[model samples]
Structures are given as C-alpha cells and as structure tokens.
Target: MSVEVTDQDAALAYYVDVLGCELRTDVEVFPGGRWVEVVPPGSTVGIALVTRESGIPVALRLGTSDADEAHARLTSAGTAPHQAVIREAYAPPMFAFDDPDGNALVYLEDAPG
Candidate 1:
C-alpha cells in the first residue's frame, strides 16, 4: 500500500529509523518525484512513499506481536508521546499515532494463535 507524504526524505527516515522498517526500494519517478518503498522485517507487504501536493489523512492499521512493547519502542524512539494503548473486552489492545505528515496509524496486538 501507499501513503502520501509531503517530504519523502523525512518519511523515509521516520519509517526506516523510528519504525524499524527496512528500505526495499528508492528510485526516481517521472515528472520529478520519488518512489520509495519500505516494509517491516520479514513482512511481504510494503508501504510506498509517494509525494503529494497536499497532505491527506490516512489510517494504516498495523499488526504487532505485542502492543505494549511496540508502544514502548515508539515512545523511546521519541516518535510517540500522547498515544496510549487502549484495552477493551471486545477489542484487541491497540494504540494510534500520527506520522510526520499527520497520517494516522494504528498498532494492534496480533490475536493470540
């Protein structure tokens, strides 16, 4: 999947450095734009960073092995502060945070196998 970002360089740093995603591809596209792809380790699904004239609200739900640990990692990385994990009877443990371009994203604990 793709997410629109105003600055590809900043987005790349955040996703790769903060989020711990690996860089899959980084290339220049026609008409003066870049095509950058990143993915979590061992995950086939990748997120493409596309340039946009205007930013838009995007929600990306990501599954984590452990929500608490993920939240802590993000917190320690200085990428998240206000987001707190929510636990409910019917809902899985989850938390939400925004990217540099204000794109909303949710991190949820993977259901026990």
Candidate 2:
C-alpha cells in the first residue's frame, strides 16, 4: 500500500521509528522528489511516500495478526497514542494517526469473513 506525505524523512521516521518498519530502500526514482518505501517488520506490504498532494485523507487499512501488540509498539515510541481501534460495520479494527504535517493515515484490520 502507498500513501503520499509532505516529506519523506518525516514519513520514514514515523513509519520506521514509531511504527517499527524497516527501511526498504534508498532508491530514488526522482532525484528531487520524495522517493522511499517502508514495510512493517516481517510484513511484505509497505507504505510508500509519494509526491501526490491531495486533501482526501489516505486510509491505508493494514491488518496485522497482532493489532494490540502493534499498538503497544507504537505507543512505546512516544507517539501521542489515541485508541482508534474499533471493529464495526463497514470497517473493522481500524485506527488513525497523523504525520508531522497532519496527513491523516489509517491502518485497519477487517472482520473475518
């Protein structure tokens, strides 16, 4: 999964430092543009910081076998933790957090079918 952020460093810090994702690469497709992707440790799916500026909130619903555990990790890193995890109709076990620039983000797990 990919999402755009105002700055790559901020995004990387949050995704890496706070979210415990591993920096996948230093690959730069555009020399002057934001170009980096990070994946949650032991997970193949990744969140990318692109150069698309949009007002629409980017909701990247990421599911983990361990949401409670993930929350602990995020909070332990001193992120202003807000408990947004909820499983409801049309959505399941989703939560949100903001980046340094207040770009809305969400990672959620769906109810079992």
Candidate 3:
C-alpha cells in the first residue's frame, strides 16, 4: 500500500526534503531504469518512487483500516472540494486525497460489500 512517486531526483528530493522521508533503497528492475523507496524517519514502511514519471502522482492501496471512518470525517469537514466515496464494484472501497500539487492519492480500507 504505497505510492510510486517518480525516479527523478527532484521528485525524490520533494519527498525526502519536504516530507522528511529517508532514502531506503534502490531497486533496479531493468528497462524501467532505477527505482527508490523512501520512508519517513520513525516510520515503519515506505512508499516507492517508480520509473513512470508523472506530473500528477497517484497511489492506491487497499486492506487498510480507518478508511470508512476517514470518509465520514472528511464529509463533515466543509473545507476543500473533495471527491465522494467511490467503490469499484467488485473491488475494495476507497477515497481519494489530493495533495497541494494536485496529485490524487487513494487510501482504501475494506473490500466492497
């Protein structure tokens, strides 16, 4: 359950610099150049920076807890324009969160009913 940011140095810098995530490892899977995984200090797991570069970063993860509660909390907050709860029928239940740079990321909880 992680986002594949990008392999570019600048993209890596943003996550490591601004987000304060540590440089974990370099994974090479051929033809796709090099990939890196970064984790924040004191954090357990990490998200990845894949070779597929993009201006709009997106990641979707399932089987996480608290997603349904998060959706309820978000709906009550009359702040930013947000996407409604979306369930992919046969897939899991998920909702998207947009970063400051307009990158949309999805955090999922349980499978669809």
Candidate 4:
C-alpha cells in the first residue's frame, strides 16, 4: 500500500511517532527522490509514503490472486477500471480503478515468494 503526501517528513513523523508504525525503509533511491516505508506492528505489509512527482501512483493497492479475474469482476459489478490489466517485466500484473467516491485504488496480482 502507498499514500501520496505533500511532505514526506511530516507524513513519516505522523505514521511513526503518532500512529506507532515502525519505519521500514528510508533510503534515497535517486539524486532527488527518497523511498520511505512504514509498517504497522506485526503486519507484513508496509505503506510507502511517496510524492506525486515520485512516479508512484497514490492509491490503495490490494493483492489479488488473479488480476484478470479481479478486473473482470470489478467491471461486471459496474466499476469501470481505469485501464486493462498491465503486465510488465518491472512489476506484477495490475490495474487501477476508482471507487464510488472516486478514490483511486489498484489490484496487483500476488507475486510468488
């Protein structure tokens, strides 16, 4: 999962100091970009704090066993997906869609361990 925040520092502080999530990863991946992830206690998933300019979509990402099936189900239920399931070498199969309230979300096919 990930969230788009205007300020990474403030977001990090809130998630860690206030929310009690542990800082998982804090590294500068590029000259001007930093990757910060926080995980709740006893949880395997981490929430990545990113900026809009970071090229990471600000969406709630859910894991699905089959992206195609998930997409079909959502489409059939009248939820219009933003696009078709994308299969790329750099990432898992996934698709983006908006909820009834228009909040962005994504469903990613689970990657094998």
Candidate 5:
C-alpha cells in the first residue's frame, strides 16, 4: 500500500518508531523524491510512503494476532484509535486509527487458520 505524506522523513520516523515497522527500502528515485517502504515485522506486505502534490490518503486493513492488545499499545503510544474495538458477529474484532499524516488504517484480529 502507498501513502502520501508531506514529509517523508517524519513519515518514516512514525512508521518505524511509533508503529514498530521496519524499514524495507529508502532510496532516492529522482531529484527531490524518494521511494520509502516499511513493513511490519515478519510480514511480507510493505507500505510505501510517497510524496506528491495530489492524492487521496489510503485506508488499509492490517491483520493482528490480537486486536485488543494492539489497540492498547497504539493508544498508549498516543495514536488515538477512532473507537473501541468492534466485536460484531459479522466481522472480525477490529479498530481504526489514523497515522500522523491522517492515513486511515484498521487492525483486525486474525482468525485461526
């Protein structure tokens, strides 16, 4: 997933420091532009932080082993989740939160497989 940010360095810090994601890639693609990617530990999916003049922020659903724990951690870190975890029968337990750049993201409890 790609997220647009006004500042790549700050975005990288948030993803790495706040979210606990590891830096996967950071290289200048062209003058005044960079291609930065970060991924959750042990996850293959990577989130790219891009800078552009126009683009809508992304809403991403991420899988977590425990929604409640993840929510607590993020809350304590000052990410302010949007609401309490939803435990509806029709959906997995989940909660939404926004990144520093206002990119919406959801964390859903992963079902046993």
Candidate 6:
C-alpha cells in the first residue's frame, strides 16, 4: 500500500513508533524525494510513504484479530480513533482513525477474504 505524506521523517517515526511497524527501506529515489517503506510484524504487506501531493485523502483498510484489543492498544499508544468500535450491517467490527497527517484509516476485526 502507498500513502502520501508531507514529511518522510515524521511519517517514519509515526509508523514505526506509534503503529509498531518495521522500517524496511529508507532510500533517496530522486534529488529531493525518498522511497520509504514500512511493514507490520508477521505481515508481508509493505506501506510506501511517498512524498508527493496526490490531492486525495488516504484511506487504508487494515485488519486485526480482535477489534477491541486493537482499539485498546491503539488508544493506549495515544491514537484516539475518530469513532469507537462498531458493528455495521454485514460487516465486521471496525473503527476509523487518522494518522498524524490526518489520513483516514480503518481497522477491522476480521481479515479480508
């Protein structure tokens, strides 16, 4: 997955420190641009932090084994979600939150099919 962030350094810190992601790569791809990638533990997916204006808000759909546990963890880590956990019709329990850059993201209890 890819996300457009204003500052790569800050994004790296947030994803690594706050979100508990492992820094996979941090290299300069161009003169002033960088190619930073981070991946969560026990997961193969990588999130690329791109430093460019895409003019669109990022909305990442993530999954956890338990919504309540994940919510508690994130909350204790100082990430106040936009909404508390809720069960929608025909959907798994989920909650929405924003990154330091105000990029919207959701964490659902069930994994994707």
- lDDT by residue (1-113, candidate 2, tens digit) is 56767777788889899989999865544345444778898898766666565332354546766566666667787654456465554334656766567666566664466
Provide backbone clash counts, one per model: 0, 0, 0, 0, 0, 0
Off by over 4 Å in 6: 1-58, 111-113
- CA error at residue 12 for candidate 5, angstroms: 34
The lDDT of each candidate is: 0.77, 0.64, 0.61, 0.89, 0.83, 0.79
lDDT of 3 by residue, 1-113 (tens): 35555345776889889999899866453444464668888996667676444322345443456676777765567424256665654335667776567655666675346
**Worst ten in a row by lDDT for model 2:** 52-61
Top-lDDT candidate index: 4
The best-first sequence of candidates by lDDT reads 4, 5, 6, 1, 2, 3
> Which of 2 and 4 is ahead in lDDT?
4
Best TM-score among the predictions, by candidate number:
4
lDDT of 2: 0.64
Off by over 4 Å in 2: 53-113
* CA error at residue 19 for candidate 2, angstroms: 0.4
lDDT (tens digit, per residue) of candidate 4 on 1-113: 89889999999999999999999898776655677889998898989899988766788989999999999999999999999999866568999999999888999999877
> Which residue pairs overlap in candidate 4's backbone?
none
* Model 5 spans with C-alpha error above 4 angstroms: 1-58
TM-score per candidate, chains pooled: 0.48, 0.43, 0.41, 0.71, 0.50, 0.46
Q: Better model by TM-score, 2 or 6?
A: 6
Candidate 3 off by > 4 Å: 4-7, 53-113
Which residue runs does candidate 4 get wrong by more than 4 Å? Answer: 7-36
Give Cα distance to truth, residue 10, candidate 1, Å: 38
lDDT of 5: 0.83
Flag the better candidate by lDDT, 4 or 6: 4
